[model samples]
Target chain A: MSVQHVKIVKNVLAGNDQTAERNRARFNAAGVLAVNVIAAPGAGKTSLIVKTMAALGARARVGVIEGDIAGSIDTEKVLAAGACDAVQINTGGNCHLEAGMVQRALDDLDLDRLDIVFVENVGNLVCPTHWALGEQLKLCLPSTAEGHDKPIKYPEIFAVSDVIVLNKIDLSELVDFDRDFFYKAVRALNSHAPIFEISCRTGAGLSAWADWLLNQHPHLDTKTERLHHLSGAPGM
Target chain B: MHELSIASYLLESVEAQAQELGAQRVLAINLVAGERAGIVDDALQFSFDLLTPETLAEGAHINVRRTFMRFHCAPCDCEYSPKVGNFSCPDCGAVGQLTADGTELLIESIEIET
Candidate 1:
C-alpha cells in the first residue's frame, strides 16, 4: 500500500451554513423579520420576548421558537403572553441550537400569517455564537446581576451580537453593577453594536427597543425599500 | 459542547474525500482551527475516537493546527493579533475589524493508505 496525502480544504460547518442561508431565503420570501435571542440562563430572554410582544400589541403577528435542553414551559409561557404561535425544541442535551432544528421548527409555524419570529436560542454564551440560525438580528441579553465582566469573559458572543441589551437595569444599583466597566469591555470587542439598557420587570426602556425593532422590519413594498433594508442588515 | 457535531462533520468530510481517492483506510487527518472556533480539542478527540470504530478511519489520527484571532486596525493601517479574548488594537487601543486570518476551521489534508 502506498501512503498518500489528500488535500480536502473545507469548512466543517458549511453544511449548517447552507441550511441557514436557505432558511434566510424562506424568511425573506415570507417577509418575516427573524431575530435570534441569546443569553445565559436567567438573563431575561423570555421576559424580553414577552415584553416585546406586549409592546407590539396588534401591530404585528409574532411567532416564537423556544429552544431548551428539555422542556416546553417557555413555549407555553409565550403562547399565554401573546405569541400567535409557538414551537418548542428540546435539544436532548445539546447546549446550542443548530440551523436544522430551526428549519424543522419553522414548519410548525404558518410563516405567511406571521410578521415576526423570535428564536430563543438555548441559554448559552459560547456554542450558540458559532451556529447561525438564519436570523436577521442577534440580540444578546446580559443582566446586571450577572456582573459587568461578562463581556470580558464571553467576548465572542458580545462581539457577534448585533444588538446588546443590558436587562434588569432596575436592579443595577442594588447589584452595584458598574456601567462604565461594562460599556468599556463591550466596546473593546464590538464598537458598532447598539446597547440598550432596559428593565423588563418595570417596562422601562422597552419603547426604544420596540421602535428599533419596528424600523428593522423589511416593509418590502417596493424594490427600493428592499434594497434599503438589505443595506442596513447587521453583519451582512 | 458542539464538538461532537463538529467531529461528525469532520469525519464525514474525510470519508467522502477518502472514497473519492479510492483509499482503503485513512491514516490521519490534518485540521486547522482558530482560537474562536468554539471547539474543545479534547472533546473533539473523544468524539472522533468514539465514532471512528468499524469505519475506514477506525484507527486514524487527528492532527490539529491552531490559529490566533487577527484583526486589521484600519485607522492605524496595520494588522495585529490581539491578546487572547481581547480584540482591541494594542498600539492604538481601537476596536479593529476582524480579518479573514483567524476565523478558519479547515480540513487541510488527510494521510491515507491507497
Candidate 2:
C-alpha cells in the first residue's frame, strides 16, 4: 500500500461557539446566573437541585431548565419544588444538551424574574462536558456509589467543573467509599474547585452550597454592574 | 463514545478542506488524540471507516498522534508526565495543579488527491 499525503488544517465548529457566546451575552443581559449541572445516572442531580431550589427559594428567585432524553418527571419535580418557573427539553435520544437546544429552551423561560437558572444536563459525564450551554458555572455530581476513581477516570468532566458535589454522603459508611481517595482524585484533576459533600435525601450540607451559589449572583459582581439592570418581568 | 461525534466533525472538516483546495477525493486525515481524551482508537477507527464511506472521504486513512498527559507543579514549576491513572506532581508533591496537555480531539490535517 502506498501512503498518500494530504493537507493539514485546524478549524473548530465556529458556528457552535458563536451561538454559545450569544447565549452568554443574553444570559448576562438578563442577570441570570446559569449553571450546568452534570453527572452520571443515579448521581442525585435532580434531587440535589430540587433541594437547592427549596433552600434558596426564600432568598432568591430560582428557575430550572431540565434536560432529559425522555420523561417530564424532572420538570414536574422542579415545579413542585417551588422554582419560579421550570421548562423541560427532551433531546429524544441525544446523550447531552447542545447550545442550540438550550437556546430553544431559553425562549420558554422568563429570564428577567429569576436570579438563578440551573440547566440539569443529561446524566452522562462524557457527552455533557463537551457541550457548552452558556452556563457561568459548571457543577459536577459524583455520588459515593460511583467510586472514588471517577474524577481520574473521567478527568475531562472534572477538569471543566467549577464545583464538585460529592453526593450520597449519607451512605459513605455503608459502602467502601474512601473520602481521602476521592479527595485525592479530585485534587489531582482539579485543585481550585471547592468540593461539597452533601446528601440530597437528608438535606445535609446543602445550606452552605446554596449560600455559595447565591453569592454568585450577577448583581454581586461589581465588574458587571449591567447584569443587575434586568426588569422583573419575564422575557419569554 | 464521544469519539463518534468527533469523527463526524473530522469528516465534515475534511470534506470542506477538500472542496476548498479544489480536490475531488480525500486520501487521508490526521488527528491528534490526547491520552486523557477517553476515546478508544479502535472504536474511532471503526466508526470512521463505517461513516466515511460514500462520502468525499471514502476509504481515507486516519492517522492519530497520541500525546501524554502532563501536569506542572504549582510551587516548584516543574512539569511532569503522570503515569496512567496517577495524577500527582512528582517534583514538589504539590498535586496536579497545571492545565492538562492531553484530552485533545482535533483534526490536524487532511490529504486529498486532486
Candidate 3:
C-alpha cells in the first residue's frame, strides 16, 4: 500500500473562525458592537454590566446575552433593569459559548436596534478564552477577593483580553490584594490593555469604565463630543 | 470539555481535506496543541478513537504535540519559550508580550493514499 504525506498547517478551529467572521459581518451590517465578557464564577460580571448600564444612564441603550450553565437568573436580572434586548443562553452544560452559539443568539434578537450587546460567557476562565464569539472587545473581570495571583495563574485569559476590570474594588482594602503585584503580573501578559479598578456596589469609578465602554464603538460618539470640538473647547 | 469538540473538528477537517484530494484512505494525522490551549491530550485522543470509526480516518493514528508558551522580551530583544504559570525569561528574566504560538491548535499534516 502506497501512502502519501500532506502538509496541512491549518488551525483546528478554521471552521469556527469562518463562522465567527460571518457573525462579525452580520454585526457590522446591523451596526452593533459586541463585547465578550469572560471570568470565573462569582467574579461579579453580571453586577458590573448592571452598574455599567446604570452609569450610562439614558445616553445609551444596552443589550445583553447572558450565558449560564442552567438557570436564567442573569437574564432575569438584566431584563428587570429595563434592557430592551436581553437574551438568555443556557449552555445546558457547556463551559463556554462558541462562535456558532453567538450566531444563533444574534439571529433571535433585533441587534440592529441596539447600541451594544454584551455576551456574558459561561463562567469558566480557561474554556471561554479559546472560543471567539465575534466580539470586537473582550473584557475579563478578576475580582479583588480572587487574589492577585489570578493573572499569572490564568495567563491565557488575561493575556487575550482587550480590557481587564478589577472588580470588587470596595473590598480591595478588606482583601489582601497586592495592587502593584497585580499590575505587574497583568502587564506581563497584556501590556497594552488598560486595567480598570471599580466597585459595583458603591458605584465608585464606574464612570471611567463606562466612558471606555462607550469609546469602544466609534459610531457611538455623542453630539456633545462633536459639538465641543466644533466650538474649539479644550476637553471634558 | 472543549477538547472533545476540538477533536471532532480535527477529524472533520482532515477527512474533508483528504476527500477533496480524492484520497481513499487516511493513515495518520498530526496535531499541534499549545500548552495554554487548555485541551487534554488524552481526552482528545479518546474522542478521536471513538468518533473516527465511520469516516475516512477510521483507523488513522492521532499524534498530538504540545508547544511551549512564547514570550517576547523587549529588553532581551528576543523571544523565549516558557512553561505555563512562569512567564519569566530564562536569560533576561523579562516578560513583555505574549505571542500566540502557545495557544495554537493546528492540524500539522495528514497521510493519505489515492
Candidate 4:
C-alpha cells in the first residue's frame, strides 16, 4: 500500500459567497439596499418584516424576496403589505436560500423602482447563517419563545448578524425568557451589532428599527448612475 | 441532518486533497467540531459512511475533536469553560456574559495512503 498526500484547501460551499459578492455589487450599482432576515421556525420573522415594510413604506420603496421550503403565505403577506414587488422562492427540501436563489429572484424585480430589498430566508437558524444571500445587512430575529440562551447556543449566527431583533417581546413576561441574559450573550458574541427588542404584534419599538434600517440604505443615487452606464454598454 | 451535507463537503474536500497529493486513498480525516455548532458527530460519521463509497475517502476513519463552550468574564477577566445548564462565569459569579468558544467547525487535517 503506497501513500501520497495532496492539498486543495477550500471552504465548503454552504452557499455561493462569490455570487453573493456579485449581487452586492449589483445592489450597490442600482442604489438598492438589500437586507437578509434570518431566524428559526416560528420566530416571527414574517411579522417583523411586514411591520418593517409598513414602517418604511412612507419613506422608502421596499421589495421583498420570500424564501421557504414550501408555501407562499409569506410572499402573499409581503405583497399585501404594499411592498413594490415580492418574489417567492420555494427551495423544495433545501434548508436555506443561497445567493443564487436571490440573484434569480432579482430577475423578477425592478431594482430601479426600489430603495430597499429584503430577502427573508428560510426558517432555520443554523443553516441560514451559513449562507450569505448578498445582503448589505444581516438581521437575526430570535423570539422570546425560543428563550434567551439562543445567542449562547448559536453564537455564529449572532456574531454575523448586523442587527439582532428580539422579537415577540410582548410574550417575554409569559415565557421564561431573560432579557439581561439575552443582552449579555449578544454582547459576548458581538459587541457592535445593535439589539432591538420589538414586538411585531403590539408595534412596540419598531419605529426605531425602521429608522436604523433607513440609515443603512446604501448610497443609491451614485450607484443608479453607474448602473445606468452599465445597462447602456453594448454587451450588457 | 445538516451534518450530512457537511459530511459530503468534507468527503469532497478530502478526496480532492488526496488526489492532489497522489494518494490512492484517504486513511483518516480529523475535524474540530465546536459544542455549539449543533452538529452531531455520530450523525456525521453515519452520513460520511453513506457518502464516501467509491471515492478516495472510502472507508476512511473519521476523527472528531470536540471542544466545550468557553466563556470570558469581563469583571474578573477570567476565561472558563461553562458546564451544561450552568452558564455563569465561574470566577466573577457573573451570568455568562461572554461568548462560548465551542461553535467552531473546521477540517483540520487528513491522513492518506498512496
Per-model CA lDDT versus the true structure:
0.87, 0.81, 0.85, 0.81
Docking class of 2: acceptable
Assign candidate 4 its CAPRI class: acceptable
Residue pairs whose backbone atoms clash in candidate 3 = none
Worst 10 residues of 1 chain A by lDDT: A220-229
The local distance difference test score of model 3 is 0.85
TM-score of each: 0.90, 0.87, 0.91, 0.84
Task: Specify the highest-DockQ model's number.
Answer: 3
When 2 and 4 are scored with TM-score, the better candidate is: 2
Report residue A21 deviation for candidate 3 (angstroms).
Answer: 1.0
Cα lDDT for residue A55, candidate 4: 81
What is the C-alpha lDDT profile of model 2 across A114-172, one tens digit per residue?
77889999999988897778899999999998888887788888887899999999998
Interface RMSD (Å), each candidate?
Answer: 2.1, 3.7, 1.8, 3.5
Give per-residue lDDT, candidate 3, residue A181. Answer: 81
- Could you tell me which residue pairs clash in candidate 2? A6-B111, A7-B110, A8-B109
Across residues A1-236, which tens digit of lDDT does each residue of candidate 3 receive? 57889999999998888888898887776667888999999999899889998888866678998998899989999988877788888888888888888888887888756778889999988889988889889999999999988988888899889999889988977988899888887888888999899998888889999988888885765544544577888545
- Report the C-alpha displacement of residue B17, candidate 2, in angstroms: 2.1
Clashes of each: 0, 3, 0, 7
Best by lDDT: 1
Native contacts recovered, in order, as a fraction for each?
0.79, 0.47, 0.85, 0.31
Q: What value does the interface RMSD of model 1 take?
A: 2.1
Predicted candidate 1 versus true structure: per-residue lDDT over A1-236, tens digit per residue: 99998888889888889999999999998889999999999999999999999988766778999999998999999999989999999999998999999999999988876778999999989889988999999999999999988987887788788999999999999999999888877876687899999999999999898888877888734433454466774321
Measured against the true two-chain complex, the DockQ scores of the candidates, in the order shown, are 0.60, 0.47, 0.69, 0.40
